[model samples]
Target: MASRRHPLATFFHLFFRVSAILTYLCCDWFSSSFVGCFVTVLLLLSLDFWSVKNVTGRVLAGLRWWNQIDEDGKSHWIFEARKVPASNMAATEAEARIFWLGLIICPMIWIVFFFSTLFSLKLKWLALVIAGISLQAANLYGYILCKMGGDGDISRVTSSFLPQTVFQTACPDDFQKPGLEGLEIHQH
Candidate 1:
């Protein structure tokens, strides 16, 4: 199931992730200003986060995630996979594999960096390291949920606490919510 259509998204999916890693690994060689390196790495990470959550996952893996607030003002995390028909062009195996690999691997690298920074007592870099870990880990976790529930199981998971209209309005027509028939609304 390899796809050739999303080469550009695949490129950027890995580009920002790899760039952030390289920048962190060789920050000293690239610049003398701690602020410069810190800002640069954060920017790359932010781009990677946005691209993965909003663009690459949707294009390459048919996955998208977001947080929504219900009328009760409660927050809900929605993980969605695009509805694709059998005859449509599904994501290729290669691109999907690359998306998942990049999603999973980057956070592990940041975790290792976290411990290394802690052990070395480089507290100055701790904040930056934590930021990287948080951002990467968030995408990883959301995608995992999105993929796990790709078959519309998310409706089941979220329907208990949320109103049926929430999913309907939040996703509109792009996503598939197969099990919505069984949802029951609870009043506070």
Candidate 2:
């Protein structure tokens, strides 16, 4: 059986996504200053982005991405792919759904806000909302690519990455030593 996310992790994952929307709406009730409202929304949006990328993503989905500067000063993204068994694929899919759904929906809410402010000639608030939309969209793109690349299923890299000893131990019955006969283990 696949391990489930902690209750608190799940709560915060949903909370942060929803709070971003709620904060923007509620800011009006608290103050009339456009700058104050813009800053407040920006802070909440940042919190949502941070929580989704760092806490919820790692805890719920077992996925993470980071950029590293190599010795030659070239930057590259290093992704961590958690080894999940076939049985846990469904759970992983569910987590991915939540993550992607939030990514799609949050920016949409901001888009609506953006146009409303634009039409009203609220340039200051529009600027901040545009920034929020851009940040969310970038996050969405990165996560989608990461999910596609790091899906826990076996691929060309999996065979090369898994050592023969461990593979044999894990699949003793069907194990075939590499470079012997024409046997190849192809996982679907």
Candidate 3:
């Protein structure tokens, strides 16, 4: 049986994502300055990006991703998944569901925000809207690669433009734990 899911990991998986959304939605009530609202939303988005990329996804869903540049100046996106073990993997069904749903849904919300902002001609808000969409969409794309065994091309044009390399990593003994796995995930 899988080890129990870490509640903290589940909490973090939702934390920044929710915080960023709420901050973007309610920033005007709290701060009147455009710069203040922009910076806060961006900071929350950055935190969401970092935490999702480096921490919660691995613990909750056994996935990690990064980009590598070859000596020739070409970029390769690498998506890695933890090898399935003889025993069940650490992620519980609920935890994995939470991770994936949160991963998938947030970007969709941002897309709705994008169109709403565009149609309203809220030109000043467009830059922040784009940033939110890009950051969330990147995670959604990376994790979907891991979930699908990392084989699918992101797109033919993207593949031709940037290239991609996918590999599976050995599941570390303490795969369910959070701290040291960050270093191992980046290892080729």
Per residue, candidate 1 scores C-alpha lDDT tens digits across 1-188 of: 43477789999999999999999999989789999999999999999999999999988877788878999999777766665444443444456657777887789899999999999998999999999999998887677667556334545643441333334334545544342222122221
In model 3, residue pairs whose N, Cα or C atoms come closer than 3 Å (at least 3 residues apart or on different chains), thus clashing, are: none
By summed lDDT, the worst window of 10 consecutive residues in model 2 runs over: 179-188
Kindly list the per-residue Cα lDDT of model 3 for residues 44-155, writing each as its tens digit: 8998898999998877777888888999998877777765443444445446657777876788888898999899998798899899999998887787665554555657
List the candidates ranked by lDDT, beginning with the highest: 1, 3, 2
Candidate 1 local lDDT, residue 2: 36
Report the lDDT tens digits of candidate 2 across residue range 64-102: 665678899987765554545555554554564465556
lDDT values of the candidates?
Answer: 0.75, 0.63, 0.73
Backbone clash numbers for all candidates listed:
5, 0, 0
After superposing candidate 1, which stretches have Cα over 4 Å from the reference? 1-3, 83-91, 150-188
Alpha-carbon lDDT of model 2: 0.63
- Kindly report which residue stretches of model 3 are placed more than 4 angstroms away from their true locations once superposed: 1-4, 84-91, 155-188
What TM-score fits each model?
Answer: 0.75, 0.68, 0.75
